[model samples]
Target: MPRVIVVEDSPTQAQHLGFILEEAGFEVVLAPDAETGFRRLNEEHFDVILSDLHLPGDSGFDLCRRLKADPVHRNIPIVVCTSEVDPVNVLRGLQAGADGFVTKQRPPAEILGCVRRVLQRGCAPEPSPSARTRVTFLDQDFELTAGREQLLDILVSAFEDVVHINAQYRQSAVALREANRKLEQRNLELQRSVESERRAHEERKRAESHLIQNEKMTSLGQLAAGVAHEINNPLAFVINNITLLRRDLGYLEAMLSLYREAIAPLAVGRPELVEPIEEYAEKVDLPYTLENLGRLLERTAEGAKRIRHIVASLRDFARLDEQELKEADLNTGIASTLDLARGRASELQVALETVLGPLPMVTCYPARINQVVLSLVTNALDACKPGGRVIIGTCVKEDGVEIAVTDTGTGIPPDVLGKIFDPFFTTKSQGKGTGLGLSISYGIVRSHGGTIAVESTSPGGTRIVVDLPIRPSPTAAP
Candidate 1:
């Protein structure tokens, strides 16, 4: 194997050259500068020296001149493997006595071929004095003292490489322009497709949103009416009981006034005066009045308490004062929802059953969860006909709590089941539903990082399960 020394200022380039030469069965020594290259040459006889034009201490051009000046090393071949491909650098390398000049851009095979050719010529005798020529290039004067044939060979080979590289660059430019045109055309088509789809999606969202708002208004009206009914019954009985108590008090007050006037004037004969008071008390039916008054007061108090309970349930369901997330009991929300829904359940003749199990406190928007419970239970009740049953239950789960609403009524059809959660989709008759209930509930659950799903068999019944994390995700919005 022929020994070659690679001198390159860049460590990476030196390694690359050394690897190529060694892979081709040459003994390669790497040098990071011209000084190192000379040091390596002194230690061992090298057949070829591959060097870059730029170096930290001494350049490749300087190395070429010094080597050619030395009598013993002058015969060694030097190849200037540089990235500088200009005519100026080529002339300078040749004038400095480089045996052959090759650009770093040349393929490995071409570089290897150049090196082999230079090695063969290094055995030839030095060029005669008459063979040297004085030449002027790029406005600089230079004498080419290297072998005439060898100089011409290196120059011609470099020129051919430059011409080949230019042709390749021209072809690459044309191909790149064509690729760019196709990419631009494809981008325009994709932009148009995306815009059209965007408009359609926005239109659908707007329509669904309008329907959802209308449904919300309808639900609000129904809730108001139901709450009013729940309040009015207790209020009416309370007023009636107060009226009866007032009339009995009036009779007793008149009898007491008559006894005071008659007994004060005749103290010794007050027994006869007491007879008139007794007769007046009998006319008023005082004993019956007293007995009924106590009952009326008790009934009035009970009615007042019922009214207060209805109001409290309404407050819980609305959660008007609470907006943000808080540690709340899901069971409490469920109970409140049931309290508000009991009236509707009674009217529908649907038996409302509960199977409440132990549940953990969940961090959530209490009002929204209450709304979810109400929506689910109301749907369950609506699904059932007379004598049907709706069961609402809650239990603890691994990471959270689950609420399940099961109803014994007509279940969803298989074809429509998948679309149930889709906005504005419903099985109810026209004007009966806006169909955003379950969709809204789904959104609420998703916002809480929870899941809600339904299980149903046609004509058998439907069970909707809602799983809520004990602690909602931080990103959850009220």
Candidate 2:
């Protein structure tokens, strides 16, 4: 609570001000003159002082000057209240350093308001606006009673400025909140867009890799077809000529037999013809040659037939002109693939063995199945060391046929075995492998309505099994 001193000569007026100050939670002290007021001030501290212009001794103006001049009392605010509204009296209050001048006729609320402002402003110097107006425009006529309104005006203006600043702050707060909300929304949207793009990028890359794999397979099919045709043409003529040579040799041998029988009788009389013929027969080993000539021709004919069979398998496996599914023997396809991979097996010194079980013809894409077998067999050969063995076997299944390629070599490591079918993952060094063989083979088998699996352990060798449906599903067939 603030403390105030009342230096009024009239008890009624002084008591009225004291009632208002006391009601407003201030400690009130009363003195009738400057002398008594100064004594009370000397006894204890007071926050504000109220005094009357006319007093018994040393009036309010003189008290104001004296108190303001004192180093100890100068900080306390002094307010002058009197019926004297004359300009000279107001000017005298101003010169004496009075903090404020309020007429005794003013309302209690306005008086209390002035004291509140004075307390809030504290010990700062507040020059009287009315004093400045009087000094600057002395020639202008103005009523002294109206000067108090100027002080209220200054207080009202300060309150209005505070209200305006609060309103502006509220508006800025609302704008900042809206901006933060929008920024959070944009950040979420950006995150979603980034995730979507990442998935799309991955899908595009996979599609690209699949397309390249398909294109290579198609080109390879074409090459195989052309090679088969070139080999078949020459093979036909070679077989036909071998057949003719075998027949002519049979006729010549029969005639030679007849001549030797006739020469047996002529040898007693005319030995000249017999001697030359016998010498030629001895030099040529005629007995052994005649015995083996028929068997040699048969072997040559068998070799020709084998060559013809291999060529036919190559043609069926290529299937360059055939796009639709057809009846195919898995055993035959495996044999064809084995034939194709034989060169690689030979180079790696891996023996190729086949155990083809009796299997019914299944409707399938023969060329694609052959490709899968070839890839599997080639991989097995690659895994083998010198003198290693690769076995390709086909067996009958309840709903499909199984082709398995087993190799006797170092097995696939457990850690890498899982990723063997993943695109671009490989254990083979550098350019030795593209890492797409098993991945493409997996896709091919799936497209054919089949499943392919591998089994291997460290140093135990590896076995790959392909289980293909006897006939592709109606929806799966192309």
Q: Best-fitting candidate, measured by lDDT?
A: 1
What are the runs in model 2 whose C-alpha is more than 4 Å off? Answer: 1-205, 270-273, 355-361, 394-401, 424-426, 429-432, 470-478
| Top-TM-score structure, candidate number | 2
Count clashing pairs, candidate 2.
Answer: 0
What are the TM-scores, per candidate, against the unseen true structure? 0.47, 0.55
lDDT of 2 by residue, 1-478 (tens): 8899999999998899999999999999999899999999999999999899999979998998898678888888788886734555655666676667666765688678767766665543534555444442356443222235435543463454355456767988999999999999999999999999988975775676588677877888777777777888888898998889888998998899899889989999899878988999999899888878888888989988988877776776777777789888778778776777787888888999998899999888888888788888888888889999999898999898898989998889889888888777778899898888888788778878899999984467999999989887776643
Which ten residues in a row are the worst by lDDT in model 1?
A: 209-218
- Against the true structure, candidate 2 reaches a TM-score of 0.55
Q: Which pairs of residues clash in candidate 2, taking residues 3 or more apart in a chain or in different chains?
A: none
Instruction: After superposing candidate 1 on the true structure, give the runs of residues whose Cα lies further than 4 Å from its correct spot.
Output: 1-293, 457-459
Report how far off residue 318 is in candidate 1 (Å): 1.4
